[model samples]
Target: MTYDTVAETDPAVARALEGERERQNGTLSMIASENHVSEAVMEAQSSELTNNYAEGYPGSRYYGGCRYADEVEQLAIDRAKELWGADHVNVQPHSGSQANMGVYLAVLDPGDKILSLDLTHGGHLSHGHPANFAGQVYDVEQYEVDPETGYLDYEGLRETAEEFDPDVVVSGYSAYPREVDFERIQAAADAVDAYHLADIAHITGLVAAGVHESPVGVADFVTGSTHKTIRAGRGGIIMTSDEYADAIDKAVFPGTQGGPAMHNVAGKAVGFGEALQPEFTEYAEQTVANAKALGERLRSHGLELVSGGTDNHLVLVDLRSSHPDTTGKDVEEALEEAGIVLNANTVPGETRSAFNPSGIRAGTPALTARGFGENACREVADLIVDVIDDPDDEAVVAAVGERVTELTDEYTLYE
Candidate 1:
């Protein structure tokens, strides 16, 4: 992790890198869509494969000097297949969004209809948000979680699919904190004769470790980011049946992306190999258990949690009910000052702008990676509640920041 080589050429960038390392070591990262990858994975991502230009699939590359690139790419594909139990896996997409674009290009023509969850209700922008290309290219409609219950309204989703008659129905979410029933979503898609694209970007590790239900066989196309719960290199992956293998490969290669980042593919191979170990299952289980404990403790302090609690690694807290005057951004900044890092996220039935939303999203993936268990998560929750109660109180923030430093030191990382 030393930056001596970089320092020789660019001392400023090296200083920033060292500062980042220190920041991570000092802070608690509760961001749901993030995790700590192993140093082995990091090494692989910084390998010589970064210089390769393998334009096509293994055994049929469009460039020469790709022997090692071919080996690394095939290993990533094989390990991803083993992890997810897919008939075909594409490790080429630059990101989860690009993977979705690849799927769209494979099946849908311009102006084809898409039915997905509403953004404020825990959906991703790639799932047909107006700001993303998917919304502009396709005719899109959306479903929402039951505002009262804070859960997906399956019947409503089915009804929407029937009425919209979309070419594709997207399942899975970014901020939703429950086990997604891929079968139910698939049934909705089936009812409308629409393809089901399940984007499991946030919970890839949970699904791979069997802690959460997988969408590999249920959904027609599955996409995920490697760097989230999976803790691989920073990249995207697409999984599907062999029926659409050729189309998907072509769409990913010539349609959405060109040459793959083979270095990241190497990282995927290493991280996926690590996930296949028995300890990873325990890690995934602990992540969920920690989240539950965190949410329960937060609720005990009278903070309102969306859905009242969580079944996964993340919990969304609606500040409007308990802390009526507190915006998520206010709490977010206060928590950061206290050395706790998460995000201000929009909640279902949001009454404010996305930038300064009413909810704060927190998760346990990074904390779990740092060896945090239920007891530690509860303590973190207590600290968060303390900050939420008096965000502008300098003394309170300073006290919480000291406790955070102690916790971070107790559960050390990257050492």
Candidate 2:
């Protein structure tokens, strides 16, 4: 992981690189969508394959000198198929958003209707936020989690689908804390003859490890980010039945993106191989356990969790009920000052701006990757509450910062 070669050529960039390394080593990364890939994955991502342009799939390329590229991509595809039990897997979309785009291009024409969860209620932008292309190009309607229960309202979703009759019904979420019932959603899609697209971007690892219910068999198409809980390289994946494989592949290549990032595919291969091991199941389980402990501890402090708790790796805290005056950004900045890093998030029935919303989202994927367990997570939760209670108190922030340093030192990441 040394930058000696880069330092010899570009001292300034090398300094920033080294500084980022030190920063990560010093802080607790509680962002749910983030994780530390193993050195093996990193090395594969940094391989010479970065220079390749294998514009097409394995065994069929648009250019010469793609022998190595084909091998690497095929390995990644095979590993992903095994990991998710997918009939077909495409690890070529540059990002999870692009994977959704590819799926959109494969079936729906512009202006086709889409039904998805509301962003303020845990949906991703690609699912059809007004600012995103999906929203602009498609006719979109939204579903919501029950305000009282803070959980997906399946019956309500069915009602919406029956009325809206969307071309696609999108499942999965960004900040939700509970497990999804994909079958219920699929039934809703079926009632309207719409495609069911389950975007498992945040819980890829949990689904792969059987720690969470998978949407692979229930949904018509499944999409995910490679680097979230899965701890793979940074990329997106699409899984579908053999019926749609050719359409998906063509849609990804000529429809949305061109020339896949072969180095990232290599990284995906290495990371997927790692996930296939028994240790990954333990890691995924620990990730959930740590999140449960973190949520329980936060709830005990009188904080209002979105769904009251978690069945996965993240918990969404709606600050309005408890800390009525505090914005999510206030806690986010204060926590960063104290060396704990997560994100300010939007909650259901949001009354504030998206930038400085009513909630904070915290997760255990990165912390679990750093070897933290429930006890450590509970301790971190206490530190978080301390900062939330008195964000403007410099002395309190300094004290919590000191403890964060100790915890990071004890956990020791990327060494």
Lowest summed-lDDT stretch of 10 residues in model 2? Answer: 406-415
In the range 1-415, model 1's lDDT, one tens digit per residue, is 8999999999999999999999999999999998989999999999999999999999999999999988888888999999999999999898999999999999999999999999999999999999999999999999999989998999999998888899999998999998899999999999989999999999999999999999999999999999989899889999999999999999999899889999999998999999999999999999999999999999999998989899999999999989999999999999999999999999999999999999999999999999999999999999999999999999999999999999888888886
lDDT of 2 by residue, 1-415 (tens): 9999999999999999999999999999999999999999999999999999999999999999999999999999999999999999999999999999999999999999999999999999999999999999999999999999999999999999999999999999999999999999999999999999999999999999999999998999999999999999899999999999999999999799999999999998999999999999999999999999999999999999987899999999999989999999999999999999999999999999999999999999999999999999999999999999999999999999999999999999887
Model 2 ranges with Cα > 4 A deviation: none
State the number of backbone clashes in model 2. 0
Give me the runs in candidate 1 sitting further than 4 Å from their true place.
none
User: lDDT for each of the candidates?
Assistant: 0.95, 0.96
In order of appearance, the predictions have TM-scores of 0.99, 0.99
Q: Residue 140 of candidate 2: its Cα lDDT?
A: 96
Q: Ten-residue segment with the worst summed lDDT in candidate 1? A: 406-415
